[model samples]
Target: MPVPAPPAALDDSPSARRREQRGWYFYDWANSAFYTTIISVFLGPYLIPVAKTASCAQDFPGMASDRCVADFDKLVAANPGLGYVDVLGADIRPVAYFGLITTVAVLLQIVFLPIVGALADHTGRKKELLGGFAYVGALAAMALFFVEGDRYLLGGVLFIVANLAYGSSVVVYDSFLPQISSPQERDDVSSRGWAIGYLGGGLLLALNLVLYLQHESLGLTESMAVRICMMSAGLWWATFTIIPLLRLRNRPVPAHETTALRSVGGSFRQLGRTLADLRRFPLTLLFLVAYLVYNDGVQTVIGNSAAFASEALKLEQEVQIIAILMVQFVAFFGALALGRLARNFGTKRTVLASLVVWTAIVVAALFVAEGQALQFFLMAFVIAIVLGGTQALSRSLFSQVIPKGREAEYFSLLQISDKGSAFIGSLTVTIALQLTNSYRIAIVSMVIFFVIGFVLLALTNLPKAIRAAGNEVPDRI
Candidate 1:
């Protein structure tokens, strides 16, 4: 098939712009499968068993009986601290190995994503770049089906690649917001994308959960069922990505582009320039900091909620799964509802309001006692309402403050905050848990993030920030 010609400029006609926006939404629907099924649901648990197999073979050759391989969990419980594998002469727990791999991926994105953003801006090939990264990530996700037995190393490598690609693609994907939608339209457009993504991811996760729960009846091993779910997520991602690649057209390259921006070295230099240039946009920088801090809290809450429920509240696994599914489906409506709220109240104000709610949620979490599943469910519902809204509105609001021609570069910096700041919140939780021996204290510690983020964002001048970036201040904001 012939490649589509890049459009000389964004087609601003309502119909044409709407068509592109619709196509853009599908990319969210596409990539969200990887987030939901692979990252959130299966990979870590699956890899633990694989890593245990290696540990059993190497660390306990005498104990490498059938039961050792089949009942690694029981073996670990019995042995306590002996459940570890030697990797590069270091003893690494299976769970620690997974965390290390994830950290490595985030670090790689920190280094490479800015360069990718610079390249996208220079070449005006974001559509191609987005598709390329998405497909590579999808292929890596698909390869997870082949990881079994003692193949944890292979799984780790594939996960790192897929995660890096996923993060890079998102930077390019977010850069499209300014080009495709007018300032007044960004909140609704971004919210719709997020909402559709939640629906798609939830649908796939629900199906996978059913398949996993029934694997024995279907004559499938649990491992095989998980592997199939991972591959299905990859297939879903790659298949739906075709829509945006086909429908979204690249804007014309800037007419005054310097020759230096045409090569890899140029991209690196441009990234450096972009980093230094950030000082020129104080409100943008402030917003970025606010986003990083609060988003870290949001990520921490979402990431550790299951652990808190399991350990602190003593909720059963089935109840936890039901709550997760509820969050997924409820968040779909939440994004839309909050988008409407932003339309009426302004994006910045709505996001600030969400931050207040986030603060209240963490504080409220401190009081939920063991076996209070109903209270836990109510908390999850409130989290679902704010989770998608905070993130989607923040994305749109940030788009308003970035310089016109440097959208990709600015969004890449935002992407760093999005992907990199989770560690800070997680570390705080770890420290809180260690100091207090209480999961409730650890979870509620996230309230600091929301409080700090709210203070910083509340002080930013949204209309002035928009005007400083050479963009129109939207009527509402």
Candidate 2:
């Protein structure tokens, strides 16, 4: 099969652009419910705690037996080498203890996403792969409604499974950028998608919150609220995703005659091929490493920030939930505004500026120990401002630079760099919390990722790769 040129003026009509843009943004909205309502706000903090009921008074903070505290004392005393911080804290939940699991999943993502991305490129199955994951994941997330009591195992299982789908679906969706966007318009489209996504995600999250609050009022256990939130996220994802699944059409590529299984096999091969071809695209590969590291940090914060605060800061669940809700709406316009800022200042500068804000946020958080609700709320707002913009610009910027004739394949690698490394971030924070008993240290740790990523991104030579990747630069990737 011959390599094809980038897509040319394909679906460039204003009406067509409007449809695609909305379709892309809607996916964000659909997925946002899970991230916002479940991961960020409710599940990790509220659900995890609710899920950690003890059989005896020995479990909860104050009631832990004198013996248990003595045991902790003896363990530390015996191993004078063992620091107080190293001892498993009273506040951290035991059931949610397998913090390492998320890291394992992330590592798996790094290994597989690019291969699938390459396969999507060769087989033109981006839409199928993405939709397949979305529906399957939606179902898995919906099943979480049944999770109750010590069903932490069930919840963890479903999170890993559904998150796998979420991770893969994003690769397919993001790969479409180089197909539908002109270089000039990619930032706008990415930003608009992100902004609308926040709105979409926020709307669903708000609705789900209402359902969750009323779960008991409607005669259900508090745990059932989790079930309702989970189901709504899935249902929201499934319904909203149909727009893109129906409207998105892949760019032309060589006709690869192969069965779906065979195509998957070919996907693995293409991954190797992309890596072997890496010598020809230095800037892209360099940028990938930077993104992989920093994005790992970003993903970690998004996934576990609330959990860390709730556990370490001893924050109220209601306060955490409200803060999360605030970020969703703030992110909506922040994405839009940041994209425009990028247009004026360039993607690199805008991204760098965002990193600076993230760094300061870490510093601020480190100083805020008690009665810092306003400070914490402000931090959440800052996250809203930078989160969407950073991700949106990063995607579109990379779209502007990837090699030609392998958009899906290259973009898949990009996804690995972004979402695949999320586990690394989560684990880092969790482990830091485990080590230092300080959410501040964990928050401070993330700054290094952003700083290093910014430095490397500054050093990346994008325009040259834009040329090396060739005439297709303005067309499809």
Q: Rate the local accuracy (lDDT) of all candidates.
A: 0.83, 0.71
| Decoy 2 TM-score against native | 0.87
Tens digits of per-residue lDDT, candidate 2, 95-126, equal 23435446655667767677768777888767
lDDT of 1 by residue, 1-477 (tens): 565565565458989999999999999899988877777557755675688788888757887545676676567668867767776777776544554566567678778889989988877788889999999999999999999989988998999899889989999999999888998898889999999998988888888889888899999987899899999999999999999999898887744334644566767777888988878988889989999889988876776676577657867645666777788899999999999998888888899999999999999998887998999999999998988889999999999999888899989988865633265776676556544546688778888899999999999998998888889888897
The best candidate in terms of lDDT: 1
lDDT agreement of model 2 with the native: 0.71
| Deviation in Å, model 2, residue 48 alpha carbon | 3.5
lDDT of 2 at 160: 72
TM-score of each: 0.88, 0.87
What is the Å distance of residue 284 in model 2 from its true position?
A: 0.7
Query: How many clashing residue pairs appear in each of the predictions shown?
Result: 0, 1
